[model samples]
Target: MIVADLSSRELRRRLSDDGLYLHSGPFICRIQSVLAKVADGLALAYADYPLADADYADFHLRLAAPRLRRWISPQVQFHADVRQPFLPLPQQQAYAMFEWGLNWCVSQHANQYLILHAAVLEKNGRALVLPGHSGAGKSTLCAGLVYGGGWRLLSDELTLIRPADGLIQALPRPVSLKNASIEVIKQLAPGAIFTPTVMDTSKGSVAHAKPPSDSIVRQQECARLAWVAFPRYRAGAALNTQTVSVPQLLMRLAEQAFNYSLHGQDGFSTLLNWAQSAQAFEFEYSDLPQAIAYFEQLASQPHTQLQHEAAPV
Candidate 1:
């Protein structure tokens, strides 16, 4: 059964008591919380995700609302396997904290694959990996591609690469948008569904866009890496795609990778193979619609020998 099979009351009850175990592509996470907003957020953002059976889980997580803190200023703390791993957030930011906390847990501990701080999306059988620094509009660009550009979402934060085969492991989850990107996506994709916006977090007014139901249903499907684009959002800049050398892509990807060194030769070999097989580019844009159009064209065009400089650091 999926999350939509449960009523809001049932979901809340499950989260408050026995916990809600749900499938997130390759991993199963059991989330427990007393915060009502958490239930609301999950129902909106994860309604398409399957409910995992009680027998197994990769992560056991909880959001605790301490009575003392509630009496004082009202806060929520994130716990992993009964140990608090993060500071308490304002009670209103419980759902955002849960989302961010879960990402932290996976990125820090899941070393079976080479994890990159990036977003991955697919069209046909090829994946487009967006690796960018904070405030680089990676998530924003990803949400647009998924909802408006007819691509499937593989992941919004973590790009898991299987070193053995150089395939992207899908982990379709809600796309987290910060500050202005939330409304930017709303305007770009009118049908996009989002959780309630939480204000004044470390990321500044964070919100989450629900992944397309098609993406969630097909989350188990993996794809070969086809393109790696480092996106930058500059005000009023025209859409531009610059060819990047394989060495440049490797260095940049290593900087953003979570487990590059941990995988040793496997990581090096996989990245080298990936660079050989996939095209790399540095993408900068200001207009969302034009950017979407450019990517669509890029995906459809035939691959050619790139004659250009290395990408910017």
Candidate 2:
């Protein structure tokens, strides 16, 4: 059964009792929370995700109010397998805390695959890997592509690369939008659903956009890596893009990887193989529509062989 199949009362009961085993891509997260915001967020954002069995889960997590501070200066704590990794956050931000905490769990423990801090989308069986730092417009462009450009959302935060086959494993979840980008996406896809904007947390006004139902349904499907684009957004800057050499791309991607040092030589080899086979580029743009159009054109092309320039490593 999917999350939508459960009534609000039942959902809350499960959270307050045992837990809700949620299937998100390749991992099963058993979650327990009494916060209304957490329940509401799950109801709206993860309604399409499948329910997992209670026998075993990849991660066990909980968000609950502190004992003494439950009434005064109320805050919520995120518990992961008896360990509280983060300090308490405002009770109003419980849902956002849940989202961030879950990301922490996967990025820290799910080391079976080569995970990168990137946004991934797929089209025509080709996956586009957008690796960028914060405020680099990666999520913004990803949201635009999935909601407005007809691309399928693979993931909005973590990009999982299976080591053996080098194919990207799908982890389609809610796309987190921050500050100004929230409204930008609202205008981009007027019909898209979003959690209520929560103000005054770290990251300045955070919100999450629900992933498309199609993406959630096809969470198990994998896509071949085709393009690695490093996107940067600058106001009033014209679209500028250039091909990047494999070595340069490898070095940059290594920096973006969460556990590149964990797998040692095997990780190096995996990334090297991926970079050698896929095209890489540095893309800079100001306007979202123009950026989307550029990618749409890139997708339509049967073959693209841009000149690669070597840079200082």
Candidate 3:
């Protein structure tokens, strides 16, 4: 059963009692919370994700208001198993806390696959890996491609690469939007669903856009890596693209990878293989529409033509 199958009351009861086992892509997270915001956020943003059996879950998570603090300051705390990794935040940010906490769970513990702090999207069976630092517009560009440009969302925060085949494992979850980009995305995809923006979070006015139903439906499907682009957003700057050499791409990807050193030599070999197989570029843009159009054109080109046209950096 999908999350949408549950009645609001039942969803809340499950969350407040035995916990809700939510299946998204490869992991099943058992979430327990009494917060109304948590239930509402799941109802809207995670409506399409499957409901897993309670027999087992990859991570056991909880969000609850501290007994005395709730009466005074009203704050929410997130727990992963027995550990609380983050300090409490305002009660209004409960849903945002859940999302961020889950991301922490996967990025910190799911080391079976090489995890990169990047967004991955697919089209025509090929994946585009966008690795960027905070404020780099990676998620903004990813949201545009998925909601506005027809690319399938694999993941917005973590790009999981399976070492066995060098293919990307799909982990299509809600894309987080911050501050001004929230309005920008609303303008880009008016019909897209979003959680209510929680103001004054550490990340600055944070919100999450629900992944498309199609992306959720195809969550089991994986994609072969075809391109790697490091995107930067500079207001009013014209679109610029420069080809990244294999060595440069590997070095950059290593920096972005969360568990690169954990895998030791095997990790280096995996990254080297992927860098050589896919074309890499540094992408800079200002306007979302123009950026989307540029990628759309790139997607339509033959592999040979793309290789010939790429200017070495």
Candidate 4:
């Protein structure tokens, strides 16, 4: 049975320039979004939800409104409200940040959390979080992990990380795939469930993969921070681990983090602690099969852990 709750939609009598709609399920705090209208009038509607009761734009009406304020951690305090004046069209960029930023805030307050810019996948005895920027082959890499590598995907976008302690909390959500990665993953993992393609956006025709069944089944299971591999898709770079410096890695991650600095020093320290705790690597490669092999190899070594040791002289 699908459990759900939602909020109130504040409408401007005038049609919005881009016609954007973002809704958060009661069970989930982050906004689920779709640009309602496109330059060509291509529409993306969620009227037909697959589950028992789907989310809508009016969850705040519930007698118990979300404690949105309490949800915002001190380190992650920021303002984003529809009450603010409207902006220009093509709302995907800001909207993407909004949808995920709210999620980062809401997730931080959960018991023991740390939100990560990573893709999480469960393998033999562990879970892997591949955190990287836009061009990083995280989604495509995660696609193979779920399909061929026998791992359950936690998320193809963001993974929750607890700041208090260094636990990689599972914020199991659908995996979003863009243009090229879409066909790649589909060909590799034929059985993967996908939401309808929402066309005419900044990212060009986008879609989401239904979260892996295991993430849904054990929704409460929290995966620890195991591997933090910052991957890059080089056209033909040799499959190798280009060690990402602790400071540099954290720097790159901070730039991409929604609440990295929101948590301020705490956020910085949280990331630092995480980098030192997990196996950190900057993977550069073009072959998906070889990357999978690399993970397989890394997972086989004894003590296989890659914690930070004092830098040698």
Candidate 3 lDDT for residue 92: 94
lDDT of 3 at 226: 88
TM-score of 1: 0.95
For candidate 1, lDDT tens digit of each residue in 179-272?
Answer: 8989999998899999999999988998999999999999999988889999999999988889888888878888889989999878987887
Candidate 4 per-residue lDDT over residues 1-313, each given as its tens digit: 2221111132111113222233222233312222232111111112211232223332111111124433443111123333212232233333333434444444444323445566887655566778877767888888777765667666666676667775655555556678888888788778876655656756676766665556566555666666778788988788878666777766766766656655776787777766666667778888887888888777666535565675432
Q: Residues 1-313, candidate 3, lDDT per residue (tens digit)?
A: 9999999999999999999998888999999999999999999999999999998999999999988896887999999999999999999999999999999999999999999999999988788999999999999999999999999999999999888888899999999999999999999999999999999999999999999999999999999898999999999999999999877998999999999999887888889888878889999999999999988987887754133333343
Ranking by lDDT: 3, 2, 1, 4
Give the Cα lDDT of each candidate.
0.89, 0.91, 0.93, 0.55
TM-score of each: 0.95, 0.96, 0.96, 0.66
Q: Which wins on lDDT, candidate 3 or candidate 4?
A: 3
Worst 10-residue lDDT window, candidate 3: 304-313
Q: How accurate is candidate 3 locally (lDDT)?
A: 0.93
TM-score of 4: 0.66
Score residue 313 of candidate 4 by CA lDDT: 26
Q: Model 4 scores what on Cα lDDT? A: 0.55
